[model samples]
Target: MIDFSANMASLMLPDGRSVRGPICCEDDIRRVIGQVADAYGFRGFLVLAVPDTGCNSLEANAIMTTYPVEFLKGYDSAGLINGSPVIQRLRRSTIPFTYDAHQLARRRADGKGDAAICVFEQAGMPRGIYLPVHDAGGHRAAIAFGGDRPVVSNDEMQELNLWAGILFSKLVEVRERDRRGSGSLSRREVECLRWAAAGKTTSEMARILALSEYTVNHYLNRATRKLDSVNRVQTVAKAMRAGLIN
Candidate 1:
């Protein structure tokens, strides 16, 4: 079995910006998250945007959702469960929560549960728990410990959120950096280019990054203009030459 506890310290992205260490591609993203899930013995994971995230562009660094590659590929793209109360609570609240699944079950008895969403997806179902980290701005993401038992309890929730908060806050800073020198690329744009250099297609990138294909392409195009490159491949090469994608 792979040991993830040791690997946790090395989960940052390549720029040394916020991700614990150098992770350059989707494989790296998947590998690290997969490790976290395995270490916690959770069923799956996801990294995405909270609803209050103020998006300036359709291709902004609004979110980066990750799950088992297969599941990500096959999940109902229609956002089948976006309106469930559990997810709504996940979004609006930054204080960690320990959902009383029994409470929810009782609510269900009174015809209150979202039947299509299932107990597995709900944190208060008495079986799974969602370990969420919500930034002060309400941009949040979560890791679900949905299996035979709960991996995240209320106490553990505080610790995990504290750790994740530090990492994500740094990421948001880099991704949304201000314009300068008449040619500034935000950190998110730089990251997208770096991944592209490593051969990640837009759709593949969208999966690792909680974004739509159009959004991924938007970051690429913006970065390309900033670097004055004529095309995607050229953009990648130029980014390398300028120390943007090393």
Candidate 2:
């Protein structure tokens, strides 16, 4: 869990609105949605993390407004994500869109819509806007704000898009940091990899560190195993990508 209370204590919007909160833990994601919903005058919202490759499988990480647990379970069990019209439209477009629940239900009535539409309808989310987010790494995600009445304005939708993108990116960063810490790479192994990344050979690293060549090789091999890399080049690449080594 991350304590983002301090950072979110005073968030000022360009439209002269202020939002303060103590957003902490995975559960706090719902809090964020609620806050945004209140600010935008919406009844509910959902933040979904969909991988660029497979939109059908949503990441374990997500935030949603109040909905029955069984509703979500049934949707997932039915694999409704694969047939979601919103996701299908998002895949084809680069801009945000608005969708009406009643329209979706009518379209799906003929068996042309996804089963997920029923889940949303049951939850009382009949109207909403979809914001597509693209990160620097090319990962795609989306945020949806749902309400019985249309409360989100064009400007509010733009702001919500920015806020959701930042929040999702921060979540990814926190997860990555946790993963690296759990890897438990040793100080010596990281040090050796750092030097190796700096173009230092095993012999050169050994001399510079006042260690035997065999010891340096041992550290390199250990790091390689820890990173699950088949060779030194791959080890260096993996370590660098993980920010374990420069």
Per-residue lDDT tens digits of candidate 2, residues 120-233?
677677688888775668766677777676656787766676667656666566445535664757666788898998999988997797654645676677678778899999
RMSD of each: 9.0, 14.6
lDDT of 2 at 129: 87
- Quantify how close model 1 is to the true structure by its C-alpha RMSD in Å: 9.0
Q: Tens digits of per-residue lDDT for model 1 on 25-121?
A: 3334545554554555555445555444332221132244333333333223323234344456766665555454445545443253444234334
| Clashing residue pairs for model 1 | 12-19, 12-20, 12-21, 47-65, 64-210, 65-210, 101-124
**TM-score to true structure, per model:** 0.48, 0.56
Off by over 4 Å in 1: 1-38, 52-62, 69-75, 98-128, 131-151, 177-246
Each model's lDDT comes to 0.52, 0.65
Off by over 4 Å in 2: 1-17, 21-30, 51-67, 77-79, 106-117, 183-246
Residue 135, model 2: lDDT of 62
Highest TM-score among the candidates is held by which one?
2
